[model samples]
Target chain A: MQLPFSLQPLFDFLGQFTDGPANALIIVIALIKIALIVGGLLQIIPFIILFERKIISWVQDRPGPNRAGPWGLLHGILDGVKLFFKEEITPKGVDKPLYLLAPGLTVAPAFLALCLVPVGPIIQGAHLDALVSFLRLDPSIIGPGGIISEIPLAITNPNIGILYVLAVTSIGVYGITLAGWSSNNKWSLLGGIRASAQMVSYEITLSLSIIGVVLLAGSLNLYNIIDSQAGGFWHWNVMAQPVAFLLFIIAMFAETNRLPFDLAEAEPELTGGFHTEYSSMRFALFFLGEYINMVIVSAMCVTLFLGGYHGLFPLPWEAIATWITNISPSFAGFYPWVIMASYLIGPMVIVPAKVGFFIFLFIFARATLPRLRYDQLMDLGWKRLLPIGLINLVITSGIIAIDLMVTGNGQVELATKWIIGAITLGLFLAWDLLYYSPRRKAQLEKDYRLYPKSAKKGEKPALAS
Target chain B: MLVDFLKGSALALKHMGNFIIGKGNVTLEYPEVKREQPAFFRGRHRLQRYRDGLERCVGCSLCAAVCPSEAIYLEAAENTDENQVSAGERYAEIYQIHLLRCIFCGFCEEACPENAIVMGASYELAMNKRTDFIAEKDDMLDPAEKGFGDYHEYDPYISHVTPESDKSAKGDPWAVKAEH
Candidate 1:
């Protein structure tokens, strides 16, 4: 089923002026998609900031920004305008070139990585042909008279999608490091150095955690990974590789420089961190980069573990279409359009909803947890998450290898995957409940007994422990 | 560790849920709505007067002497038959209180022998300039029509404690009003 209105007709219309491989038409469509996506992302950043404020405020039992526009909807835009009008201060004896370049470096890579993310399912082949027939146009007019193949929802679907995302996102730290060094301020330099170190340390575990998902999916292309997780929620990599999901999420927090891993920008210790010397719109750019990076990370998490755009229970589009057609023959034309609309719009909606959940989790964690001490942040990343990720990767590969040897196929059966997940989860729970909890309680009791009692009603206790 | 994390998060979620249901919000929406201060609340001071439009203060300087911050200053002048100011022999000729030094300790009110000075329920004492903080005699004095401006007039316990015998004493300024 295909929607009656699609870019196919527009592509065909534009194909008339283009010759030689229809590259011009493809470029035109790609440009339009890019414009829409980038524009949408820019527009969404302010609201995401607003959402963070609102959620944090809510967790603190206060009404958040409710005065700007009904429920403070315009608060984010107003903040942007305020930041735009503020004076940009260039401190003395700073590296002006790197200082100026830092904000751009920070923002550009996140947007670049967004290019490879598959926001919606590909619209192609039969759908495009159906669209052509609906428009009563000759198919040969576009792309050598054949259907224009696939119209991917992504801006650009690179074969090395995950690698590109990892590589591009890692460069965001350079912007922070340069911003810090260029500021010629102690706090900024400290923040920048911390960001670089923290990101570098976590990047290892971050990439390692994803290897489990990559192994399970047997593809590094994000779209293929999503495809492998299709059918149901259980098939999602999160269910198959829970340990990886946990490690990935922890590493992701560090990579994003968010709390409890946000030692880079720890306000009490590092002041404003890497952007301490930044002011006005330059500061806003760093903020924009941070939030957009958050969105990108959330999107990647959704694409990898949360089944991308796949809904938990597949919608009965075909059944609904058939039922509608059965109810009235006159509404027969509405059948395919309904299915096609679902096909086009379903993933677009589902993916954001999943991403929004992750974003909310990010905000929730910030509200619930205190910023980790710098050493603790590094310790968690290097000692805890790194080891867990490596172990998870090895165990996953060993299972896959054994499956290959026994069944002549590398794919672990769904039952085997469930059994592994259950065992991992069970072991974690048992350790926490039976061992860790009792030991912690006994330690607390012993500490309480060791605590000195007050000497008397009016006398002071000794200061010595 | 994970369980503890989950528990902490669950507690936050509980608070958030309560906030959404309008249960846990402690914000007072200040400025638009002012809180009602208790009658005993120590605020800015007010000089009292008698029913016949006579000043309650006899220029004894008890409040000035009792002020821990030395915020109060006053001078006394003898009252004559033609120019009677206070019901007593001496009247306060010049009275002032430096609000900037005042700690709102209610000590001055407690030490007033004539029951002439009392703290009023006006805590909005913010002023723009240093000179503006030096409250003049007229500024602290009650209007002539509203006799005996002791804030204890609103306190049921203190109002009931004024001796009934004092009501019959001639020229006694400590006499409680009949309305009370």
Candidate 2:
């Protein structure tokens, strides 16, 4: 189980200083990976905030925070500093314990869930065995029985990756609920209730939506899911599971408390929502939690649907590498490291780019759509998305089951899946354009006609007299 | 529904595209760049003077009488041969306009028989104290050495429209006056 592009060389290098077992070295490497991912994510979160502001402003035809730094890059940092120094107000009669615990609770699950996301591919065939030998390191010191094997790019890859993500993210609503309840404010309570109800309602559809991808991939492990879609862009679950993709994205918005479904934090209705009584660093934590949640969901979407860490077009890397080596024989010695670097760096870039696009979509939706009414939010989650998700799941499983029974291959052909996906999307579009929209408009008009018309133009309706 | 959603998104994307290309942005970057007010825009009031430094007001009190807000105050004094302040028999001895109370309707300018008061283009009338809002006689007086000190001199467009030749051109309906 030799992991392609393993950090074993670095592990071996560090092993020189320690007389500990290989297991200890593995723990140290895992800790380093965790620090790098978490620290990198924390550092990037501020910029994501700035990016959101700038993008929202751009959509509205305004220059957002250009004064903070060049293109307002430092604005998020300035905001963080401001929030840090602000006075933390604990409202009188508030439940102190839950109030103190809520923000951390909201943020912790998001970070924990992030551990399961594979931001890069575990490319095979990039053995650093040559490098290990070149460094004069004995094989016995590096691993059990000196077998150099697979290492995951993710901090941790649990077998139940998607399930773990769902379970952990579900816990986030508790923090919101606790925050709302402990505040002793009606607004916060209303926001918290809304958040809980909304999360619970959408979580059903959110989970249901991903089952199509899970069924197709035949694995819940996020890394395995990504591996299933490793061929190219067309092979991505988004292409095969278009209906599920739509449902998942919509449910994702509701689950994350973002606009169009952000009834929990609907400013007009609930003021600041569950965090209304919160101020200073406590409030900042909630804010941080929301943005982190956004990042996590975006990454999750990429992992599940958008071909995690895979580029749109498949390039002939082996051919390119050979061409480079053939040009100069001296480059042959460093060929393995070059291959490892490509494998390591390629997904590192691609994953963020994909995740960034989804994040941008989040901002784009926020800028474009108005917040859904509370009833409408519930209606969408239950009546619309849930039903659609169920139908999609039924149809998806039906196809797979039929394919397995007929072909005995236990897999639906890509062409058949692609055609079905296209047809499903096309049919939905047609139905929406030809049937649903006009009928909805007519119904709205009929509802409008139920009211009495003004006697004359610009005049009040005549009284019953 | 999807079409409508896409339309709305396209509209926003279009605006974003325009923003990126530096189009359709109405923001003035306010403190750095001020907007140009219209020609007939009523703003701060200024008292005028004649070419020989004689006061334009004849102390007729028409401005005070016509002021809807009663923001103006004045005291008339007889002008003798030794102390000839105006081209008329009397001069405004004491004059003040309480800006805080002023509606800035340019009625005083219209009512002034001697063209003594005209609306200046200085709209930034913020003051630290309530009393500081009151424009004294000297404060409202044009700080000019000679000539009919028209407040429009500061605005090139207004100055260009109402040239030096049109100093006393009154009630000429066909004349090219500052349009709103």
Off by over 4 Å in 1: A1-21, A132-147, A344-348, A409-412, A427-437, A440-465, B38-119, B123-180
TM-score of each: 0.81, 0.82
Each prediction's whole-model lDDT (CA): 0.80, 0.80
Candidate 1: interface RMSD equals 1.4
- Residue-level lDDT of model 1, residues A1-465, one tens digit each, is 334565555655665677533555677769988997888889888899999999999899998888789889999999999999999999899999999999999999989988987888776666666665665545664422463567778898877889999999999999999999999989999999999999899899889978878877788898899888888898888887887788778888888889888887889997888888889999999999999889899889889888887889767777888888888889887876786777766445787788889899999999999888787787778777776677677777887777667887756677766765665566556655775576787675555454445467777655434
Model 2's CAPRI class is medium
> Scoring each candidate complex against the real one, what DockQ results?
0.56, 0.61
lDDT of 2 at A327: 83
Please give me the total number of clashing residue pairs in predicted model 1. 1
Q: Tens digit of lDDT per residue, candidate 1, span B81-127?
A: 99988878898999999999999998888877676777766778888
Residues A1-465, candidate 2: write the lDDT tens digits: 234555556666665676544655668858978998899999998999999998899898888888877888999999999999999999999999999999999999988998887876653233444444444545665422364455578888889999999999999999999999999999999999999999999999999989989988889999888878877898888988888888888989988899888888889888889999999999999988898899899889999999887889776666777777888778775566566666776447888898889899999999999998788788788888887788778887887787778888766678767865876677666766775577786675555464454467777775432
Error of 1 at A104 (Å): 2.0
Off by over 4 Å in 2: A1-24, A123-138, A141-148, A407-412, A430-437, A445-456, A461-465, B44-119, B125-141, B145-180
